[model samples]
Structures are given as C-alpha cells and as structure tokens.
Target: MAEPTTSSRRPGPGAGSPAVTTPALERTRRRFLRRQRARRWLAWRVVLATVVGLAGVVGACWLLFFSQFLSVAGVEVRGTSHLSPEEVVAVAGIPTGEPLARIDLDRVESRVGSLAAVRSVAVSRAWPDEILVEVEERVAIAVVELGGRLRGMDADGVVFRDFAQPPRALPRITTDTVTRREALTEGARVIAALPGSISRSVDHVEVRTVDQISLVLGDGRRVEWGSAEQSGIKARVLPALLQREARTYDVSVPGQPTTK
Candidate 1:
C-alpha cells in the first residue's frame, strides 16, 4: 500500500528545481568564484594604488611648502647701484627660513621700491634657498632747492636724494614762488630737452609757472624758453642763436627766434 502511494511523487529531482551539480561542475564553479575573487582583488589593488599615489603627492607638497627643505636661507640683491645690497635687504624685510614658495613677492617689492633711490624693483624666488631682489635706481637729472637743501631730481620729476652742495654736472632748478610740483615738472621737461653742449653752459633753470620757464647760462646769458612746447626745435636753434653773442635769446617761438 505505501509503494503504491510513493508512485505519485518523483524521487530523482524536485519539480521546477535545477538538477544536482556534478563534482567537475562544482570544481569549475569554484575556479570561477576564485577568478572573480582575483578580479575583485585586482580592482581593490588599483584603488589602493590610486590612494597611495595621492598620498605621495600630498606628502611631497607638505615637504615642499610647509617644511624647511624649501625654505629661504638667504636674500640676494641685484641691479642695485645707488643702494647697497645690505640696504635693500634690510628694507625688503624678507624673513629667512620662510618657505620660498610662500614669500610675498609683491610685498617685498613694495618695501624695496619705497626707498627714494629705487625707481623700480622686482622680487622673486631664487631656487632652493634664496630670495632674489632686483632694483633699478633713479638717476639724477637735475638739482632743486628744497627746505634750504639741494635735492636730486630724476627725469620723472621726482625729487629724491638730498645733497650738502649742488652737483656741478647738474643744473639748478629754481621756482619763483615756493616750490610747486607743476612748475618743477615743466622745468624738468625744459631741462631734459637741452643739448649736452647747451646744458653744460647752463647755470640755473627758472620756473615761474607751468608755461613760464627760462634758463640762465653760466656766462650770465638768459634764454627765454616760454612753455615746454617746441623743445626739440628750440634745442636745435639755441646753439646757433647763442653764437651771435646775445645777452638774452628768445627761442620760445623756435621758428621766429629773437635775440636781444
């Protein structure tokens, strides 16, 4: 009776279920799983490599910027003529042992350029252990009386260094009233235009207003220069006019020059 009941059910495999695996198939599946595991390990290895690379870059940045390995050990000055290297370095105030990459080049340049003698300045890092500062000094083109002291004026009309006595090579600039910047600028333009031969004979430059400028020669000869306009033409004509032995030469209108 039990055998007859068992005949209604299947014994080899369950209905709608897969067949049991063979030992070879099991081994193949295990190898495939091992391969998948190896692939996963490889992916993890790539991720680990990327992380290690980033960490190395971060470490290198730290060593370069934050550590003393790239710090400034000295300050080097160049292109300094009127100012001594020590003076430039002292004013630069660049701290030694600071990170070279972090040094404020603009700040350093500003400090160095503040010196009256410096016309322009550049600051930069000089490799592993130095900060380089290059400076251009202002050249004296004329001398002006300021506060009873003679001061050197550059071509840019900036009155810079003070002198105990007027320089023999440079012409004196005098303003009728108390020194005004506009008058000085006009006088500077007039003086700058004079030929070397003519400039060498000049005694002092007279500035009344922006448009009123004149020159007095060492021989007590006066030159009426008027405004700073037509300076090149005036410069060309003055030497010839002076050859005529005039006490006063008017080259304000260079084309219609007059001598008295």
Candidate 2:
C-alpha cells in the first residue's frame, strides 16, 4: 500500500514472452496444412479419373454394339454342292443391314438345315459385312422308288431328293414300300459293304425283310445274301466265286459258298 502496490498483476504471457514463435513450429504447422490440402487434391483427382474411364468404356460399347459400323451386308455360303448359295441364303433369311452381334446363329443354322439336301450346317458372322453359312450335302448311296417316284437314299437310310428315273450309277433299293425304313436301312448297308467292283456291277438291292437281302447284278446274275451278317467275308468270297460260270451265287455261308 505504501509503494502503490507497484501494479503487481504479473504481466500476461503474451506481454511477458514477447509473443515468441519459432520458425520450426511455423514450418511444422505449414507442413500439416499442406498435407491436408494434398490429400484433398489427390482424392479429387482419383474421382475425376474414375469418371472419365467409365465414360470412355460406355462410349466404346455404344459404338461397337449399337452403331451400324458392324452391320451385315451380305450372306456367303460355303461347302454347297446341290443347293446353290442363293438357295441357302434364301432359306437362311438373314436380314441384311442388321448388326452382326444381333444375328441369331442358331436360328440361321436351323433354317438352312431344313433343306433336304443339307446333312449338316454351320452359321457364323464373317466380320465387317458378311454372314457365312457352311453346309454338308447329302450323298446318294442308293435310290428307292416311293409313290411311283425314285428318291435318292443316303447311308443313314434317309430318302431325300426325288428323281424322274433312278440314276444308273446308284444301286436300286427294292422294298415293298419306301416307308419301310428298317428294311431300307438293311438294304443300304448291304450295298455299302459291297466291293467297288461288285458295287459298280450291281443293278438292284432286294430287301424282303431286315435280314433277308439279295443283289441282282447288271448281267442278270443273282447273289443270295441271306443277311447282313458275314457281309465282309461274303464280299471277299463273291468275286472268287463269280470266276466260275454261275447264274446264282449263294454267299450266305461264305465259308461254304455255292454256285448254281
């Protein structure tokens, strides 16, 4: 009280410490702020990149799938023999100017396969502007008369194309009715098993039943082929037996072949 209390309220920290601030501390604070800013910038950059990438992929898909750059322009046929390419293309009915990716390959195959001459078929896009159709045509191994018309028969016993007259090159398949598929199958097998020389000389194949089969040669010679069994042996034995002058040769028992 005598010295007027000398204003002893101890100076505040800022007044006494002269507002001390170290360069190192300032630098550390600045570094921390920089790191936060950097993290935000990096996050923003990653988001932008992801959006751009997605846009690019979507744009590419649109161009390839939806655009007309890859549309079909024409249909091409391959491995066609009896049926013309135009015929196959007509049957396929592939819509021109449609996107290649949009074409249904299975549907095209089924349509082309329905042709009687087609044994097997494949359909595919030939890229750029074409659809390719490949087919295997049925080959006639024998001919059968059905409804007063001669039809070509394949090895599988399928009676396909009808003919005005039986081709001289193919063996005639004589069955009670063309609907007798089993007998026709057996008769086909008998004809298929014959040696080339014998096949060329054969005139007709007679099928009374599945097992009962016979061959009439071009020279009026008859071969009594009881069944398809032992056919390979019979084929081998027949030529040897034919060397002898005989009107009828029984190769049913190939081991004991007899000539009449």
Candidate 3:
C-alpha cells in the first residue's frame, strides 16, 4: 500500500503560474498594442493635416501673387515748372491700364529726360495703381541769336528751345553765334552759376571766353568775374567790395579783388 501511494505529480513550477505571460497577459499586450497604434495613427493625421494646410497656402499664393488684379490707372505729376502734364505723359510711355510689374522707372525717366525742356527727372511708383513723375525744367537765362534762329539757354549749361520768334522777357545773350552744344553748355553755366544776389542785381551775363565772364548789373554797373571758380569766396567778398568799390569790380581771383 505504501508503494502504491506515490502520486503522478511532476515539479515545483506550474504552467498556470503568473511568472510568464499567458492568455490574460496576451490580452493586456493587445490592449497596449492598440493604444500604441492609435498614437501612431494620430501622429500621421497631424502630419497629413499640416501638409495639406501648407499646400493650400502655397496654392493660394501662387494663384494670386501676380495675377494683375490692379494696373496703372492714373498718373501724377509734381515739381514741374515748364513742361505740361501731357508732354510729360507722352515722354513717360506708360500706357493706360498697363500692369505695374511692367513699368520700369529708369526707362521712363530716361525717355522723359530726352525732352529738351526736362533738366532733371525723378520717377516713382504711387501705390498699386499709379505712377508719379517729377520733373525739373530748364530755367531760361538768355536767348542767343544764331543763323536766323533764336536758341534758348538755361543757367545749368543746357541749351533747350530754339525760337523763330524770341520771347519778350528772355534776356539777350550777345556772344559768338556758335550753336554747338559745348558753347551753349558754357552759356547755360554762365547763367546758372551766378549767386542769388548777383543774379538778381545783374541784368545780363556775357561769356566771351572760358574764363572771361562779364555781367551787367541793374544799375548800369559792370562786373568782370574771371570765372565761375572760387564762387563762395567771391560771393563773400562781393557785398563789401560793391559797397566800397567803384561801378565795376572783378572778383574772379579769390584772394584778390580788383576794382575799375
């Protein structure tokens, strides 16, 4: 009976023990996997949504950035003295309803400056639908009669108008009848280089040579300014010299003032 009392039991470790993962553990692992998969899916959704939003923004910008929704509708003129708006517009070459992207300010300014009346030019954009053009006209200082044509000269070495009939108010420039641009340029400089006081007091200027500049004042006095150089020094001494000196004074030499 004692021999037959031994049971069929095996070892200490049991298969159903909680030492290793089983069906219940597998169920817990499945739940964990499901949660991880849900997180991965959410991350993908976020990535996709961001990509879609960026694509939409780029598409909208591409569709609208330069679609020509607005064009040049008007023109504005400023700082103009002699040239008319129509004349400036004609030189600008900006057609009505032109796309703003096509308007080149440099080209427009260059074209406009070709006009004889325009001494200087500044062109700019006036917002999305307008253009602003500023022009400075040649200030007429004298008219030179040459070869049966009266040629106008400004104070800035620029000769512009040629008149068959001279204007009444224009001062007469009686010098060599040479109509070359260089000569005219010299005439313009002669007119333009005078100081405000000298210009106001003087009636006419004669440029006989490069350095021989003579001016006739309002009171019938003569001024023989040698050249346009040392203008500041000459100007400084002019008031005192004219006060003490005779009817004629020459201040072309900066350090020396000669009176006649």
Top candidate (TM-score): 1
Pairs of residues at least 3 apart in sequence or in different chains that clash in candidate 1: none
Which residues of candidate 2, in runs, are more than 4 Å off? 1-53, 227-230, 253-256
**Candidate 1 to native Cα RMSD, angstroms:** 4.4
For lDDT, candidate 1 versus 2, the one ahead is 1
TM per prediction: 0.81, 0.78, 0.67
lDDT score for residue 78 of model 2: 95
- Local distance difference test values of all predictions, in order: 0.89, 0.87, 0.75
- Give stretches of model 3 more than 4 Å off: 1-68, 141-152, 161-172, 178-187, 243-248
Per-residue CA lDDT of model 2 for 27-104, tens digit only, reads 999999999999999999999999999999998777657889988899989998778899999999998888888899
Model 3, 28-89: lDDT tens digits are 99999999999999999999999999999987665444445557888898877667898888
Error of 3 at 192 (Å): 3.6
lDDT of 3 at 78: 84
- lDDT of candidate model 2 versus the reference: 0.87
Candidate 1, which segments miss by more than 4 Å at Cα? Answer: 1-49
